[model samples]
Target chain A: MDHSGISVLFEGTNFERLLGGLWVTVKIAAVALIVGLILGIILGVLRTFKNRPLRVLLRLYLEFFRIVPTVVLLFLFYYILPRQLNFNLPGDQLATLVFALWVAAEMSDIVRGALISVPQHQRESGKAIGLNRYQLYRYVLIPQAISLEIPATINLATRVIKTTSLLMLISVMDVINIGQQIIEANNHTHPTGVFWVYGLIFLFYFLIDYPLSWWAKRLEKKRLERANG
Target chain B: MKKKSFTRIIAAVSVFAALLLVLTGCGNAKKSSSQSNNPSSVQQIKKNGTIRIAVFGDLPPYGWVNKDGKRVGYDVTLAHQVAKDLGVKVKFVQVNANNRVDALNSNKVDLVLANFTVTPERKQVIDFAKPYMKVSVGVVSPKNKAITKASQLKGKNLIVTKGTTAENYFTSKQPNVNLLKFDSKTQQFNALKNGRGVALADDNSYLYAWSKDNPSYTVGIKSIGPKSYISPAVKKGNKSLLNWTNKEINKLTKQRFFVKDYNTQLKPYFGKEVKPSDIVLPVK
Candidate 1:
């Protein structure tokens, strides 16, 4: 009614509150991404080793995380599993764990793709120079494979941030939740403020995600040029 | 390259579809997926010297955490009264709408005092006591061109909260109305204010509060569909708690307890926009 709906987001502690919510979202996503990258590389390495049971297990892990929805996994790990396992798992910690696992499964596939894309001759040349398995990975395979993975990984980071929006459903107070809170707090004065509040939220996400996406494209171009050279 | 992108799009669409199904609970993984039949009855609660009552952690007026970070709302004040009458300390378990039924059936809480509306589907699983408040779908629109009847909104865009009685009523009974469904009431009102829809439909109690705040809009259609009541739900067949809650509700209604509760707990948040008799069940 006042036509100052957008001002509501900038009013009082509402802006600061929304920023805090974004901090929570980014903090959780960064932890998950870091952990996912580490586990992903490990699994991607393990994927190369042709062991039957281990392969079967890896396949199952990938499929389980990939196939089952993240929302279900959150419920399973957060609520149901703790009761069955007879232990206490806090909601934020469990949310991070689920997101970490999901990111790991996703990143591992990228790892597999990048590693596979590395020409077989690169391995032969490394071996011809008498590089051991560890040194070969450190110097030749990993360095080359990383270029392909970096852009994809950055893209996945944005995806991870987007998915963390779901954290609030489990009552985790992510950025979206904070927007809702601000709207609720000002529901009386700015009943129409939800439009601007959520619009700001969308802008916050776009601001974070768009730059990373642009950076990813630039990195991909540089990597392709380097590869062709 | 064209064929390859087409396949990828198909894959992405199917995965999205699967997520939609699972998220909407078609996979039988409902928020209230617990199949427990246990309901902590009055005797069990009193013997334990505490009564566990589930309430909303964020829905103000009915139930929500106040500025002091303490849970206090309309339902909460009544919960305190219920516990005091039963002579037991109260434990408030925070629950959203999705988990209220599960919290009760899983024996995590003895009673659910959230602004839970009575529905035939919910009645099959959980036993509802006598209602303490009345509600119906109300549509709010800009004052200049208000939607005064359900027929006026027959073919227009109407915003409603997903999973609410209004959504159910429109989708089932009035199929012609195009619904712009959102997740929360705040969003629904915001959608209407932003001109996404001609009117927004939700519980009349909250709609009145919203209309009062945003004077440019009005609840042109204050009531729609059959009248509904908000009630406490216990696990099915928990006769002791059910009967006790019914009697407790009846006594409170007779003594006009909720009116006082409304004056103190809800009035501040709702302001003068909402009246005690408007929300509280009438003495009969």
Candidate 2:
């Protein structure tokens, strides 16, 4: 309710700094999402192969990432990796890589689920039409699988955006970190600044995620309508 | 029907926003009016019958949570003494380096004795009582890669706890050094021990004390910047509380209260390698 605290956001470079931080968050999430999508598709497709050992290996890889906390993973890559490999890795780069690996694991599961959800008869029908395995997947299985995967992948993108907040802990100067710095600097002047500053950050994240969520819901509705009709 | 749903959603969002503003406004109104009405008079604290003091919840020897779950440290002890002098019950609110000033300014705590160092930037926001301790920023590193001079940090990775004087020093004075900021003293030291950085820059007292227990590291750089004083902070206009705090500090200094605190709480960690006088501020 104190406009004084809320006003601090617009003063001088404070709002600009927050925007810069948001850009960093968006950039990291975008890079991680793109990388995750590519890796996920490859891993997901491989996971569907009939070979037991290969499938088990992919399953283990997915489980490992799912089991570990993102913060610990970020630390391992940022601090431990540099020591072990004898190289300097920036915190932001390591954060991006860790988030990408995490997203890849989640996305792979989504991909595998979507692929498996395609009825077996569809693939069999492709074969009955004299289509080879590659053409069958390209013409029939992949197209149907894509429709199922899109909504979930969009959801995953929103999750990635939210998870970028964790990068602040590793000192990446993301939106959350900048917000903290701004509050730290100005909280004394406007005693109620913590509420307003954090509320704005909440808004920033909501603005980014709400549209994606809406799109996912719309896609789900369309998919349901097509299925029902 | 679609347009109706859309309008409903907008209405819901606006109502939520208005509710948030009202809630925040009420909270802010309560805090501001309390301080503004009495601004800095010790009478308010006396009337409340409790003096709320903020001290660090981590950062051992200065302030920390002990195994018994009690907040105990030199600063906490000093705060207790100040409360006793004021004839009010002591209420300890845990704060860290980053939030201590905010806690004071917001009236969340009546005084901040969390090993708060007086800095020019901070002085603008809050008033400090007479200093009770003197500290200097220093560098700690493994013996093999010890840093002795500022020049030695050139192109090297330096770890510092966020919001500390060490971070401020490195940012302005040794800008060439690659600085890694962690949230706490524990994390900063852990990063140093893990070889994530070549050297750790922090208060000399803490670095010296930690190095004594960990033989692999040494306090290679005794003092990086000018000595800074640790004092109790209050809201900027709280003259009565500020004056009382300064007078109590002067009295405590005369009584050598911190010297005793050093002997009991700090000596065990720092040992004779650091003297009681080295860390305690003089009475003058």
Candidate 3:
């Protein structure tokens, strides 16, 4: 079998192409994660407020994102969103927007659950110290809630990174798009290039995601150790 | 407690409603405007340095990868020339048949060079340049026992790519035939190869390409329906780009570039079955 094609992947142009795609993946995931975290925290906090209206609204928002598939959401944003909304956003930006929506819903549920899991004693102590509800949250609640939130946030981060691969479906040309380009480029040389190309993509995705997941697991373990101590 | 909770819920609903309104505004600005422009706007072409041409990478003969690992085909060659004539570099993007019109309207690609046929229904979404390549639908089956006529497929399973003319024709013309739908040629071809379907229907040029290596399979029938010509597709209202492309194709046509293109890229499979004049039609 001719292995010369493999050399170009490591050498000049193909290497740059690969790196460019990886960068898009990173940028998409990072934006999604940051945006998702902020939105998640807000929703999570609202969900915990003992108000019936907030609870129902949060429930509806969470269910919409939770039940809808990310790929469908990506298409809805990329294709239908522009036509229906009368605004034209580029594909990459739209991918980020849709992914943020998905990540926010998932992350919010995690944040809500984790924040509630923090001891009721913490809230009681804040109230006893003449802390206003806002001050109690600012000084007493958020810091501890964050510790509980980190593992779930990290989990959401890993998911966003993986899910960004779906951006390829909407024409964002991330790592999977590069893989398809490589496969299409090599089809004349190899009849079954898609198999190898997609296999390599799986490897590329795993290389990025596996470490994040492992790191999250390690962080969780350390937090658990600290908590027990 | 209930009153405070009710106010917070209303706040949340209002925020979501505002977001929906913003999204709808964006969508309206980008939809349907692809339809009103006609082909005279050379100035607009000059402003855009890159011409986006959509091709179906999985579809062979028209646009596919060859043995050298480069995308080369009749449509790719034609697109390059069209871009060169417009004084812009060509950027080929893959789009499936169903999404080709949306890609044009959404500004994803400047024009679709995929094996797109001119159809009355599709005209509502995108504009068509003059015909640069003529096409006919055909069925492919095992060479040894290929189905030779429409009736031969009467009781047999026929695989067709979804949203293609093949699917459109077969469903209307041969309703009794067991029609299998796939989104890509890759799957349909595989299904045909594996005996899941007795034959596959698609553009004749593509069916010819698939039948080439699998001497086991042959394009058993030809010219199964009305003759249709392939054209470059553009956004609906961009008359300038459309006109420019038509003029360029006219020049290419006179030089027999499309004929040469067919021979170089398509002839290996078709072997002189295609006529040169049939490549580009009178500017209609």
Candidate 4:
């Protein structure tokens, strides 16, 4: 058993630090997802309106976030926001502010797609029942659109989880950051630790993400069965 | 149907992987962090009784967290001295080559002790106390294909951490040598180990420690360019903290504290190869 480099994890408190790192990742991801869900839902609903200026404004917002890479946005907020705001935001909070905004833009697009796909007859039926725009979304559009939105929304959860990795570059001490610290600490005797350490990180990400993906697949399967039946 | 699902999965995975093609300008920390003139940082630091010093968490023998999850290294030793001089506790904020300047300028830390090499451009944005260490750029390569001389790097990709003196030197002086820049020491060394480049360029001091750890490699190019110095830097013109740091450095230099720090924190890693006089600047 060539345990040479593998000891880096088992040695001292290194493994515990990696878990702390994961917890840090989870904290950031949780903030982003929860805030994103609220803001995204609101933005998504707003995007469905027929107002031209609002449409143009929302389209520009979506295009800007979509066209700009997420990592650049991460750096933008991590480094620039403090200067612009003249106050410090804790790293995760700052990241949440940027992420929630981006996710809301993405979510709005998703919401628009789902809402428009609810069939014109459904819209007509709602209008025939004297449902106003607010009532139509509250009573009719949102319920149906939800089923359509579930899988992609679940996919967003996984995306948000993976996105937390970029926080490593900004001194966030994410699992990847902790792993790099461990590797460098043991670089002398454990030169090969990178494989084991990164492999474990791969497992950590897979473990957290696989269940969400599995649930998404299951949701899609049930929808398919309902459609066929 | 199965193919559609696979492609959908691929698309979904990439949904966050980003449709990023050629990144446009986003954030340059050095440009904006100087906006705050945090003159009261010293007063706040003293009142709080804790001085925050930013350092590299993965660069060993300079600053790194040991297996105990404790921050330790040459830079850390200096940090302890700074905190002691101010009669305050130390809060270590880990920063990297890519973000060190911003860490200080943004007021995230009262001072930066991250083996920050003093440079002409950096002087424009941050205030350096006094230098305590001497450094020059060095290249390390796999023993099998060593890069002993600068000319040997003619067209080969050389790995360097972003914002380091090595990157500045190679890009400005050895332009023909393709530079593959990473954000941290760990990544550049990983790039070198993974064969991403022919060699890695860094402070020869760090290269010396790293090459000792990874036996298959050697600091083939021992030194490069002119000798530079490393110092504790604060926000641009934060005179209170800057002056306090200067007085502290002067006192430590007179007491030969860095030589003492060298014997305890650095000597074991450097062994017989580096003497206290070789790396210590005496901070006069």
Listed in order, each prediction's TM-score against the native is: 0.67, 0.49, 0.76, 0.80
lDDT for B32 (candidate 1): 29
Q: Of the candidates numbered 1 and 2, which has the greater DockQ value?
A: 1
Model 2 docking category: incorrect
Regions of model 1 farther than 4 Å from truth: A10-12, A75-88, A128-139, A214-218, B1-60, B64-72, B76-96, B103-111, B127-131, B136-227, B234-257, B265-278, B281-284
A88-170 per-residue lDDT for model 4 (tens digits): 65577777767887887888889889999999999999999887666788789999898899999989889989988888767
Ranking by DockQ: 4, 3, 1, 2
Where does candidate 4 stray beyond 4 Å?
A1-3, B1-40, B137-203, B210-225
How does each model score on lDDT? 0.80, 0.79, 0.75, 0.82
Lowest summed lDDT across 10 adjacent residues in model 4 chain B is found at B19-28
Residue clash pairs of candidate 2? A1-B25, B40-B238
Task: Tell me the deviation in Å of residue A130 in model 4.
Answer: 1.9
DockQ result, candidate 4: 0.35
True contacts kept of each: 0.01, 0.00, 0.19, 0.58
By TM-score, is 3 or 4 better? 4
Ranked by DockQ, the better of candidates 2 and 3 is 3
* Candidate 3 chain A weakest ten by summed lDDT: A4-13
Ranking, lDDT, top scorer first? 4, 1, 2, 3
Q: Which of the CAPRI classes, incorrect, acceptable, medium or high, describes model 1?
A: incorrect
lDDT of 3 by residue, A158-227 (tens): 7788888777676676877666666665554465656665666678878888888898888889889999
